[model samples]
Target: MSMPIESMLLAVSLNFLVFSVSFDDMIGQSFASLVPTMAAVESAIGLAIFVITFRVRGTIVVESINCIQG
Candidate 1:
């Protein structure tokens, strides 16, 4: 049985969240001045995943042909 897309996405998001939180603390110890920079990096990665998900049709194919038509 296959998991729904929403479930998969939620799982991935949570995984990233955990990773980011851990990294945030580690980064905090070193360059405390770059918290904003770390946040922007996380945001950019999340946005990229969102875009790629929307681009997927049935199996993970990027709808390049549809993109050109639209």
Candidate 2:
């Protein structure tokens, strides 16, 4: 439903923000530096997995609800 999508979006955005800040601090570098490349890639992969799982699980949940209603 819309709720799941909205929550997933919020989670992904927050994850990206936290990853960026932590990665920068851990390497003592700014996002403009080369050190951010690996961190950015990892974050993207994690976000993708999170989104995929959310979609799959949300579909299952909604379908179940529909079944019950009918």
Candidate 3:
């Protein structure tokens, strides 16, 4: 489950990074100058959400399996 999700995330992030870099250079500006600040903020928020959800879901899955086995 998480493998696919992680792979998708990796692909999406890589694509965005590549696109942003090219767009920035084409516009004659530093890649990070346009959106690095905002990107950092967004990345933190997304990471937090991912961590919380993953932890909660993982806990639920573990509990369910344990319950079934016991």
Candidate 4:
């Protein structure tokens, strides 16, 4: 439930931070100016990633917990 969503956010946040650093060099616009576009694209991509992962893994924490307790 929350795990996939949190994972998605973590991935997006790391990528956004990394992209922000080089954005100034690649694009002439300031980071603040590009925030809207960056946020939109990243949010869509992050949600897609979460959906795909959730579809494949399907709340994997329960399985891991079972394995650990066994």
Candidate 5:
């Protein structure tokens, strides 16, 4: 399934934020130093995925829609 570009970017940004915060808490590292490096890597990966998704076609269809009907 193809995701919307805006949704993909938002998801990537949120994921980065959550992971960075969790890593900081777990590792007891300095946020200032860690954030930049983490952000750079996350952004690079997100951009690559965005480009690839943009080029790809077709939305993914699940066989079951019952779960979404609530």
Candidate 6:
């Protein structure tokens, strides 16, 4: 049996959300304030790439990949 991509992505995203909180806190304590600004810029660049990919394929991941079952 295979699971839907939506559920898998949701699980990963949830886990990452928790991890990111701790990771960001560590960065805040270890580095100067400007370090977090760089991470924010990178996140924005990633968001742009996601938007471009969605515009091109109408999906976040390749449709062909979703055709494959686990």
Top of the candidates by TM-score = 6
Which portions of model 2 miss their true places by more than 4 Å? 1-33, 59-70
Record all residue pairs in model 2 with backbone atoms less than 3 Å apart, i.e. clashing.
none
Tens digit per residue, CA lDDT, model 2, 1-70: 3346546555655666678787765432233353345456657776785577567566435444454431
Q: Per-residue lDDT tens digits of candidate 3, residues 1-70?
A: 4456556555665666677677764433343343445556666887786677567666534445454431
lDDT of 3 at 61: 49
What does each candidate score in C-alpha RMSD?
A: 10.7, 10.3, 8.1, 9.2, 10.7, 10.2
Q: Candidate 5 — which pairs collide? A: 1-60
Count of backbone clashes for each model?
0, 0, 0, 0, 1, 0
Clashing pairs in 6: none
| Prediction 6 global C-alpha lDDT | 0.57
* Model 6 Cα lDDT, one tens digit per residue, 1-70: 1135435544655565566677765543333434446556766777896787677667786664466454
Rank candidates by lDDT, best first.
4, 6, 3, 2, 5, 1
Model 6 CA deviation exceeding 4 Å by range: 1-31, 62-70
Name the runs in model 5 displaced over 4 angstroms: 1-31, 58-70
lDDT digits (tens) for residues 1-70 of candidate 1: 1235445545655565666678765543334334446556766776776676666643444454346443
Between candidates 3 and 4, the one scoring higher on TM-score is: 3
39, model 1: CA deviation in Å? Answer: 0.3
Tally clashes: model 1.
0
Per-residue lDDT value at 4 in model 4: 66
Candidate 1 residue 53 Cα shift, in angstroms, is: 0.1
Cα lDDT for residue 20, model 4? Answer: 67
Error of 1 at 55 (Å): 0.6
